[model samples]
Target: MADHHHLHRSTKNRNGFYVKMKFFRTKNGKPEKPFFVKHFKWILWFSLSFYFFAKFLNNHESSTNNNSLKTSIINHSHRALSESILQKPKTSHGLLNDLKVYIYELPSKYNTDWLSNDRCRNHLFASEVAIHRALTKSDFRTFDPMEADFFFVPVYVSCNFSTVNGFPAIGHARALLSSAVELISSELPFWKRSNGSDHVFVASHDYGACFHAMEDRAIADGIPEFMKNSIILQTFGVKYNHPCQNVEHIVIPPYISPEKVQSTLLKSPIDGQRDIFVFFRGKMEVHPKNVSGRFYSKRVRTEILRKYGNDRRFYLKRHRFAGYQSEIVRSVFCLCPLGWAPWSPRLVESVALGCVPVIIADGIRLPFESAVPWSEISLTVREADVAKLGGVLDYVAATNLSAIQRNLWDRKLRQSLLFHDDVESGDATWQVLVALSRKLGRSHRRLRVSSE
Candidate 1:
């Protein structure tokens, strides 16, 4: 019995020794016998346990390193993807380079005789795109649809949304995609929704009367399709409307600076500051009949000038700068009046020039926060209250010129809301545009296939 037990123990020790030799065998050496045969039982058990533990640790280290390598490769690949895809010609020129897009700029009938109030007359004062092209030094090539990376649809305010058939139905769709109060939810009908990505409707509220009304219709008609197959909705407005979470207010490129404009006009003394009071810096021509509330100009401008001209109590000198910044710096205040509703390019330029802007329009939605106090920065004048106009101007003249000048340059509201010449709004806009472009491209390919 004792010999039987001894044999079993010997057999177990021999197997353990064989395993250890198999693992540790060197290229130049033979298998070595157990160093301590007396403690063979304890050593065999310990060696077997140690072998498995060591193997587990090696495997764990190798696995950790492989996973880290895989993660690094994935990160590097994603970083290169945007740059590579953007290099494709399809998405160049403010359009996503890798995307296949077709932009059709819908020309308005008002463009033909934009200067004449008879034909181009609308509730708005300014002429349409054709007029803008003639007046401003904008490139006519921008409207060439063949050269466009994405279809450009110029949306305007019409009294009846459906009655206005501005664009041809064969290739393009009317812009009914406004991101306003009426359009902000998931619970909406399908007909109003834009189904494919091929068409992107930029719901901009830059124009005064058209903003709220057009966007209300667009949201009601669009939210449903946006849920299924989304189209890009680029909104640029001061007021935040429906589905504020999804809508991205694209920054409008700042207008040419007074210095650059002066250079273009070839005026001398470009650096010289012009301080002229109450400059009528916008488009002068207007249709008399369509003038309503904010759209109508109440001859309060003439009244203020005429009143100040005769007033001896305060030596108020009233003068017009002919929309020229050269003479604008001559006056302490730049009287910026809104035409019908609340938007005018003069307000933006006035602030940029470090002049105190006096807003005369009643319903003009103030852009800056009420807390930081724009009263410290600008003057807000009521449209009809000609009585308070003098008081407001007097108050502006009383404030410290250095503080006001400093506020204009260092102002957070002005910086955040307004666009500067150096900063490009293209990147954020491009991100949204790319997503929509891909969506539209996929839709176009799918439609082609289905039709086939």
Candidate 2:
């Protein structure tokens, strides 16, 4: 019985040992799926989350860099544009830098044929040549009207007036002016651009004021109806009373022949003692029945002749073309009386010869008043003050008179009153061009603001 019990115990012990060995093998071999298989879905979720987060960070950095680059480019462009705007206007020959003018091509009958006529080749035709030459020689002319700052109408009103049978054919002149204006308005896009504001017309004739002929009144009234809105470059820019008076219109100097100008310029400057105190040469009386009638009949000339004809201090002579410059050079002051018009070539001639001009014309508008101070250079007398002419001049201090003479000899002032071979900065033609440029720039600025 003892032997049987001991064998049973041994068997139990073997079974226990086998059971422990099997448990150790299963634990060691399988490894429990590395502790992740128990929560496999959670592991996959964490891995995918990490990958997407990393990708989003990379894209954000790239976008920030691109935005910064775009901002830098925009800022640079704005700065460049601002600098360009603030820069000074470019200058060429000291006038308008890049200003362009386009001259309208009209039929010869309108301008060329009449201007080329021998009778019209005097002072009446001078402006046409000088203006054309200046514009052509300078860099300001453009063949295309679209590129031009000003549209120049080269019709010579004075030349056209000469074409008619009678000298002062008010009806015929008006018709011709109206026709030219109508043709340009109808055919070109430029005239209608600024309602003819940018278009320039020359009417330097003494009868320019008569462009608007009133059949009943028999005189020019204001400006021609068609030209009221246009820029009229005229000699008849009278201030208060007479027609063709406009602030918008430019008053131009009369055309003195280059030959006459050269000869007068060659003379020595006025020095020491000039013999005559004042000089007058021209028609002392006019026919009562002239076209302008009482308007042309300036009694001031006759009154002066009557008052000072015998006075040794005041030299008075009937109209004589010869030795005119010699007489002017001999005089201290030249009398510029109103004749047919308020403006005369004599005023310019006196200025050329450095003689102090005693202006007696009523309502006269001097040229280049902006650049040249006429009041400082010349003496003005009223039409009613004819008897006090001597007293008026005598009242001026000798120091003041000497100063006026000195100012007349100034290179700049003399050049401003005349035309040059090349269109210079302060010359009459250049001054007109500068005025036109300013007008155009203002118009352009207005357009830009309206568009914005």
Candidate 3:
């Protein structure tokens, strides 16, 4: 009975060991897989998927935060600009002090009839109107010439010349301009005091300061001699060009009609929605008798047309001013090539409509170059590379393009380009006044030091 019990106990022990070994070991002595190891592939897949999903969520949140921040900043900046515009301009310091200007009330021949005529040459007449409006509304104007920082001679030279049909008629306009200057010089003691250096005039025409006739040189009291020391404002200002070539001179923007300005201001489209890469609508073929030799003579526009005439990316049309506003609103960039002169009204129009301008004019002096950061706002292309305009535009990064668009959309920049009827401190007229004030102040300081 004792032997039988011992054998039974030994059998039980051996059976227990066999069962344990079966679960813990394989036949070749390899360890059996754990619960996790049994579904290793599924577990690994789940872990990887979870990691990726968490990463995606994190990135999404970060992007949302960034977008929100950008929106907040833009809103804040816009609000600040609005508040600043409503406030009166402080003339406590800098160049915009208690500035005084004296405007000459010239005879009807010099001013009234020229302005009354409907056929004004270019909208250069608008400069005269804008300045007059600004003077009337602002505290800058003075009745006494003795207390003035600058004297304004509001002679509508451009308007007078606009009525002339031929080159022979230019002599009559020249005589009128010369007589006006002579009258101002003889009547006012101010012109004699500074040799017209302190006098300001608007000659913002394609022809620099309106001395177009060869006969102007022969006349003793011509526009050229009178404007030698004056602070002349012109449109087509190159460094080497006459009248505008002087250091005291300023390049003013061409006028956009009230209708055009209002339409563009109201109907400006979003930059991202602008489907057309580049849009240009103007005269493609220059007349053989075109005196300026700026249009087809250089072959810039013709070359661009030859290369990109059929390109869907580029929209080049001829004499299509009726749909100009619509086209500019839908275009990402506006091509502003030199027309009769280096400067064109299209440049200012492009900025007003929030279209980044691609300037094709070489040696062109832009308006308010000192105050406006044009290089940051516009793109310059060489005439030789007109054919490669597509590639040049394509190579510009999306980020840079967006930045330029934002600059174009800036309210202050747009306001500065506009001609407001009232004396707004940041409008085109106000900016011109401010520029003149600064220049005059510097000249005064230099004179005082020289005398000392």
**Scored by CA lDDT, what does every candidate get?**
0.41, 0.67, 0.68
Candidate 3, position 43, lDDT: 96
Model 3, 1-452: lDDT tens digits are 87545644463587655655655557476657666778999999998998687667656655676433233334434533555678765444244766777677666667667656554532633676566656755657655555568878876655644334522133355567678778777755667778878888776555556544321232223346667788877665775644435536777888766456666556654453687889998777633224443234267777777778889988999774665777787888899987556678888888877789999988787888766789988999987778778988987645588788777777677677767777676778878887887776534434554689
lDDT of 2 at 151: 74
The Cα RMSD in angstroms, rounded to one decimal, for candidate 2 relative to the true structure is 25.5
Off by over 4 Å in 1: 1-278, 281-295, 298-306, 309-323, 366-376, 411-452
Candidate 1, 1-452: lDDT as tens digits:
87545644563687655555554554456544444754798989998998687667656655676433233233334433544567542223443343333322222331232334332222222222222232122121122222233333333322222335441121112333332212322222221333333333433233322233233343444433342333334322344443322432232322334233334225433224544544544433333223333323455555455555455332243343444654444445666664433455556556645556777766444542322356776777776775576676666567676677667654343334332222222322233343444444344444554688
Ranking by TM-score: 2, 3, 1
Least accurate 10 contiguous residues by lDDT in model 1: 134-143
Q: Write the per-residue lDDT of candidate 2 for residues 1-452, one digit (tens) a residue.
A: 87545644453587654644543344555524344666899999998998677557655654675433233234434533555578643345334646777666666676667655554545533675567657755656655455566777776556544344545234455667677777777766666767877777777666454453331252535466667677777766667755445436777887776566667556744453578788888878643324544534357877787778888888888866765877777778899987766677778778877788899987787888888878877999998998899888877635588888888756677677776556777887888887776676534334554689
lDDT of 3: 0.68
Worst ten-residue run, lDDT, model 3? 213-222
Candidates 1 and 2, the one with greater lDDT: 2
User: What is every candidate's alpha-carbon RMSD to the true fold?
Assistant: 20.0, 25.5, 25.9
Off by over 4 Å in 2: 1-97, 160-171, 207-209, 212-222, 241-243, 267-273, 286-297, 397-399, 441-452
Winning model by lDDT = 3
Model 1 quality (TM-score): 0.41
Ranking by lDDT: 3, 2, 1
